[model samples]
Every structure is written in structure tokens, then in C-alpha cells.
Target: MIARARLIGVVGFLIAGATGLISSTQTWLLVSLSDGAAEPLAVAGASAVVLLAPLSLTALALGAALSIVGRILRPVFGVIGAVLGIALAILTAPIAIQAPVSAVSAEVAAVTGIRGESAIAELVAGITATTWPAITLVAAVLMAAAGIWVLATARLWPEGGRRYQSERAERRRSGGPLDAIDSWDDLSRGGDPTT
Candidate 1:
């Protein structure tokens, strides 16, 4: 069961990661294609916002979905969520790191006609444009946090499952006569709830 969950999670993460990169790349390319029709600064600002928006949203949506899904499964859900979250994070990091670097570099080149000038400051400005960096950071943080929640939820997986398995086994091992006697046995038996 855990193996199945792990497989499903890996497959889902791969699908999401691959599609996300391709789609995001396409959109950013579209933004770049807006070259001659508009002012460079507006184009830069607008495109930066556009590129960062969905990455942040995707991260957020993944986190929420993972948490909800984790709660439903109550165990393997965490492992699944964590695996998917980390895989997607690794897949998406290049683009997240790229946006500010690329856009700011482009604008800086367009404005100052220079290669690299105060790259750090430009990263800050571009990242802050429309507060997209904050949004992105929040989303990434949430994804990791949700993964942790899921991982923690699985701590009882072994013990609880083992207890249930033992009771079921004891019942299964009892004969047909015992099966017939089971209701009477329960009625006659008295024991501590703590056990």
C-alpha cells in the first residue's frame, strides 16, 4: 500500500514538474516576444509579474492539496506529499532562480546598455515588483511545510496498523465454533480499555 502510494506520488510529481517547466517556459517566451510592441520597462515589469504569478500559485495549490490529501490518508499521504513536494521543488528551482536574473539582466541591458550592473540590487527590485517574490517564497515555504505535516502524520502508521493486524489475525485464527461463540464471548468478557 505504501509502495503504491509512493509510485503514484512519483508519477504525479514527474507529470507536474515536466508540464510546469514547459508551460512556464512557453509563457515566459511569450513575454519575451512582446519586445517591440511596448515600452521596455513596462514589458519587463509586466512579464516579470506574469512569469512569477503561476509558479507561486502552483506551489500554494500543491501545498493545500497535499495537506488535504495527507489528512484523508492519515499516513502514507505524508510520504507521498513530501516526495512530490521535494521533486517539484527541485524541478522548479531553476526557473524560480532564473526569472529575476533574466528579466533584471534584460532590463539593465536595455537601460544602461551594460552587461551586469548592481545585479544584486536589480534582483531585489525585480523580485519585489508586484510583490511576486514574497508570494513565491510563501508558496515554496508552504509546500515544504505541508510535506512536514504529512511526514509527521505517518508516525503511527506502523504501530496502529500492526495492532489492527494482530486483532484481525486473532479473529481469523479462531475456529468456526469460536466465530459462532464470538458475540457471546464479547458479552461475557470484560477487560481494561487501556489494553
Candidate 2:
């Protein structure tokens, strides 16, 4: 159960991050111009929330880091992941709730050369949200849950792998003949395997 918790947390974080990245590439909103002179402009999740890509990338990195970090750092990364999840939710919630015209204002301006919030609002007849925003929201929730899982189970996790073991432990394993790779590893740890 202990190891399962660790694996579950890591997998959850990774899946959530990947989901977020995928959603960012997808269209979050379709904006129909009031003039009806042009097709609705599609606004990608990244455009809806400028930080979406960066935050998703951060979550991916945090997930990778959590897999190998020592017990002491596990909770730290957990907290960071939770905070990131919350921030992501905050950024997307407004768009999900309101589907505000400003969400696609920049795209509108790019297409029609019109600027200013009020002007763009006038140009936008309606904003229709795609499923991507909801997917992102689910990802955010998963990320936070994974973070909390890590924090709760961090203490129960086993110590890190061989590389994280103590120098004394490595030095003691010198009974067998050392291969080239093993000799190099020992040398790097400031120990001569020849003894």
C-alpha cells in the first residue's frame, strides 16, 4: 500500500499535467463576430489563459521530480503542485463561468484590426466554450489531489534509490570484482575500489 501510494501520486501528477498540455493546444472558445461577416474565431486554451502552457510544463516537471526526490523534498514538491493546481483553476474558472468576450478580444483584434475592450465587446456577438476548458479544470483538480496525496503519503514512502544511499553504504559493497562502470562510479564517489 505504501509503494502503491507513491506510484499513484506520481502517475496522477503526470496524467494531469499531460491532460493540461493537451487541453492548452485545443480550442477553448469560439467567438462569433457581431457583424456575421466572418466565421467564429477559435481561441485556444493557451490564449484563454496565457500561463496555461507554462503552468502545465511546470506541473510536468514537478511530477518528474517527485518520482525521484527524497522523502524530505516530497512534501515540498507536493505543496508546489497544489499551489500550481489552484492557480490554474483560478485562471480558467472565470472563462468557464462567464465565457467573457475579453477572453477572445485579442483574437478578434488580430482578425479585424479593432482594439479596446468595449470595441471588441461590441464586435463579439457571442462566446461559446468548448470542452477543453472543462478538461483543463478536471486536470487542475487531479493535480491538486495528487499533490495532497503525495503530502499525506510522503512519510510512508521508502527511501530513495542507490544513488541516494549513503557514501558508507556504497563503500561497503566492495567484496566483488568491480567492472569498469562500477569502478568509475566508486571513483566519482571519492572511493578507490582497488583497496
Candidate 3:
């Protein structure tokens, strides 16, 4: 059970790491492609780190939850939550980060008559300007919240013997042996196979 949860958690972490990198890179790519494209401030420090932070945290949380819960808890909700949260994060990161970046760009453009990624700047302005993007932002925030809730629910959800058995089987096939670990009887008998 613990083995299965660990496996799922590790896979979740890997997926989160990979996707986080891609999204973070894309954020920079979007920024770089903007008018002037004059490297954004602290590209490595701010952009990459900020973007990757959520994914890493989410992954860690999921892994920890799964491991703690063992096979009793499934990661399906975590997966869904992560997918939605990641999508919302990816969508809104630019909105959140770029909006400020755009403000700076606008000021710079106003002063120097140089536009770096004017299109992106305009988008930033448009996003931050008024009701439209604000509404979208709110929705994105709601979605992220829902995703978090989903993850939490997944963590707290209970499991039946069937779920435990399947998860244990999965673990046995992958990393550990089936017989090495005791079944429900072991739990009742107060035996610890992992020890």
C-alpha cells in the first residue's frame, strides 16, 4: 500500500516537474517574444522560480498525501485538481506576472517610444485594465480554488478493502512483493510487514 502510493506520488512529482518546467519556459518565451523583448527583470530569479513553485509544491503535497494515506487514498482527484490548477496557473501566471511587466513596458514605451512585445503589453494592459480580464481572473482563481479543494478531498476520502487490494497489487507488481506485506488480517493481528 505504501509502495503503491509512493509510486503514484513519484509519478505525480515527475509529471509536475516536467510540466512546470515547460510552463515556466513558455512564460519566458511569451515574455521574450513581446515587443523590445528586452529580457524581463530577473528572468531566472523571478519568472522561472515563481512559475515552477506551485507545481513543485502541489507535487510535494500530493506525494506526501498519497504516501501517508497509502493505498487507501487514490490520486484521481489529485490528478484532476492538478490538471485544472496547472491549467489555471499557466493561464493566469502571465496575467499575474505580465500585468506588472506590461505596466513597466508601458512606462518604458511612453518614455522611450520603444515597444518590447507591444502585443503582449497590450494584452497585459487589457487583462489588468477592467472587468473582462478581471472576471476571467476571478474565474481562474475559482478554478484554482476548486482544484485545491479537489486535491484536499482526494486526500481525505476513505477507501474500501477493494481499493486497498488493487493498490497493493499494483505496488507488488512494480516494486515490492505481494506476500511480503500482510493483508487485513495483519492489521487486526497487529503485525507490521514494512518493519
**Among all candidates shown, the one with the greatest lDDT:** 2
Scored against the true structure, residue 123 in model 1 reaches a CA lDDT of 31
Please give the ranking of all candidate structures by lDDT, highest first, separated by commas: 2, 3, 1
Q: Candidate 1, residue 128: CA error in Å?
A: 6.9
- Model 2 TM-score, all chains together: 0.83
Residue pairs with clashing backbones, model 3: 34-117, 35-116, 35-117, 36-116, 36-117
Tens digits of per-residue lDDT for model 3, 1-195: 432434444454445444444444432322332345454332221242343546545544654555455433444645554575556456555555555564335444554476676544553322222222333334334434544544554554445457888877787568655463445555668866564
Candidate 2 error regions (>4 Å) = 162-195
**Tens digit of lDDT per residue, candidate 1, span 1-195?**
552443343334334433443443332311222223343243332244344335434544553454334334645545554554565455445445555455455544665455654643433343323333333333444445455654654443333356665665686576323343455555567632222
Q: Give TM per candidate.
A: 0.33, 0.83, 0.33
TM-score of 1: 0.33
Segments of candidate 1 deviating more than 4 angstroms: 1-37, 40-103, 106-128, 150-153, 157-168, 176-195
Best by TM-score: 2
Model 3 score (lDDT): 0.46
Score each candidate by Cα lDDT.
0.43, 0.86, 0.46
Model 3 lDDT, residue 42, Cα: 23
RMSD of 2: 3.4
- Alpha carbon lDDT of residue 137, candidate 3? 37
